[model samples]
Target: MEKNVKQIVEQVIKDVEVKNPGQSEFHQTIEEVLTSLIPVLEKNPAYVDAKILDRLVEPERQIMFRVPWVDDKGEIQVNRGFRVQFNSAIGPYKGGLRFHPSVNLSIIKFLGFEQIFKNSLTGLPIGGGKGGSDFDPKGKSDNEIMKFCQSFMTELYRHIGPNVDVPAGDIGVGGREIGYLYGQYKRIRNANDQGVLTGKGLTYGGSLARTQATGFGIIYFVEEMLKEAGKTINGQTVVISGAGNVAIYAVKKAQELGAKVVAMCDSSGYIFDEDGIDLPLVQQIKEIERKRIKEYAVRKPSAKYFEGNKGIWTVKADVVIPCATQNEIDLNDAKIIVENGTFAVGEGANMPCTNEAEQYFLEKGILLAPSKAANAGGVATSALEMTQNSMRLSWSFEEVDEKLHGIMVNIFKNTRDAAKEYGFEGNYLVGANIAGFIKVADAMMAQGIV
Candidate 1:
């Protein structure tokens, strides 16, 4: 039986690889999830017989279009946009819209695929979908960004709605970008569908703490993990990658929990402060001024800035959190982190650690919190915003934050219980995969194959 299960897993992966050629990221994610499901498949032969894995690997619908907008120079700029409605068994499609130069079919599919399981883990009624464009917002004027967003939404508005498909923000997309997209969506649809989008400005229908949800959720989940292991965040030295929203708020929450966040990074480079990072100063530079992280070293003379971002992982610390983009931590980075005696790793970004790196961490007995479970705070809170929008009401910061914290705790418990049940006692990577997969798989099976 075990042999048959392993063969099925391998065969399915080979087929997916052939079909999804050149989509390395998508293939990587699929392989990781499938590898963890050997025990599940062995225990539940019905899933294999029904070909549920085959159906899950494929998206329900994939949309692609060209977005052409005018720049400030009176010239036209064209970019590609994509939306992969990966699954809808649980509910309508729900995910973020990323705006970066790296946006492509494979990346969108990978993100959407991950979202299916992540949303399932949240126990929210939202399904998984992701849409974005290769439109880089950096260095662009506000008017240029508005023009691009409007053009992007002119076509996207027809596909999404308050219930059909709701898009939030990710990567380069933030409150400002969400506002621009929502405005255009409203103009075209001629409806005040506040629930159609999330990450909105508070006055317009956004939820409080949505901005800090992901970061705070990471800390909350990590706290649960530490508690189960008879540990705590107090007095721990922490290093976080990416000075963006996720990283910034993770620093704040970790600090609030008595952890000293000594380092954080951006695309330009990393800043290391021996005396602990100044959260307010980081917010001023990254959020208010939108400047590079190197500015942090300039403002605080005691800190030093490195010329590259990857070096941030090599610094010695008790805890490591990668809140940056995908595949940021490779095997080499993993080796360095483990060598530095880091006791725990929490992924605040999607697939930040490659397969080999993740295995190494687990082998070293590092308490690993997978991204699907750790960084789910953002999407979970987005769902909360959707609820508020549906009810035509707003939640106070405390109200929303308390809900977010409870959700994170529940997610941690779910992941931990699933891991223990699957015989991978402390393997969160496997735990997260199995726990998230069971919910979606059961829903798909019950729905009778869409």
Candidate 2:
């Protein structure tokens, strides 16, 4: 059975690689998930017989279009847009819309593929999908950003609905962008289907605490991990990458839990402050002013700024959370982190650690939180937002937060139990993959080959 599973996984991957040439990110994600499913296939031969893995890798729908809009300079700007509805076995497709220059089909597919397991672990009714464009919002005026979003949604709005696919904010997409997209969606549809979108402004139908859900959720999962190891986040020195919504809020929650976040970064550079990161200052620089992280050092003379983003991993800390992009931490960074006596790593971003880096952490018996389970808070809360939208009611901040915390705790338990049952205890990568895969696979099987 083990041999059969191995052959099956290899064959599927080989086929995928041939079909998806140059999509390294997508191939990496599929390899990671398939590697963890061997134990699962050994136990449940039905999944293999049904060729579920084959179906799982293929997206249900892939939409690619050109987004053309006028910039502040009155020039015609065009960008590539994509939406990969990876899976809808459990429920309607749901994910975020990222707007960055790095957004490509491979990146979108990778995110959408990860979203399948991540959404499954959330215990929400939401399925998996991801949409984004190579439209970089940085340095764009508000009017320009709004126009671009409007044009992007003009086509996207046709495929998504309250009961179909719901898109939210990610990376360059935020409240302002969501508002523009949602406005366009509403205008085109000629109806108030607020549930068609997740992240929205409060004046409309956005959920409270949704903005902070992913960051807060990462901390909650980390807390559960610490508890299992007879440790706590309290008094821990933490280093987090990215100064975006996820990193900022993760820093806030970690600090509230008695952890001092020493360093954070942007695309240009990183800032390290031994006195602990100033949350307000970071918010002002990254959120309000939309400036680089080096401005953080300028504001606080005590904080030191580094020119390179990768060097932030070299800082000595007990915990490291990569809220940045995929493969941000490679094997070298992983070794440096391990050598610095880092005890734990919680990935707040999807596939933040390379395969080698992840293996090194697991081999050293470090507590590693896989992104599928650890960073599921955002989508989980988005599902909650969907529920509220459908019922025409809103949940209080405390109520939504309480539910988010409970879901994160349950996700940890699910991953732990799955790992132990599969004889891979403490291997969260395998645990999360198997746990999330089982849910989606079961649902897919029940629905038949669709």
Candidates in order, TM-scores: namely: 0.99, 0.99
RMSD of each: 0.7, 0.7
Give the worst 10-residue stretch by lDDT in candidate 2. 197-206
Worst 10-residue lDDT window, candidate 1: 441-450
Error of 1 at 311 (Å): 0.8
lDDT of 1 at 211: 97
Candidate 1's C-alpha runs over 4 A off are: none
TM-score of 2: 0.99
Where is model 2 more than 4 Å wrong at Cα? Answer: none
Model 1, 72: alpha-carbon shift in Å? Answer: 0.6
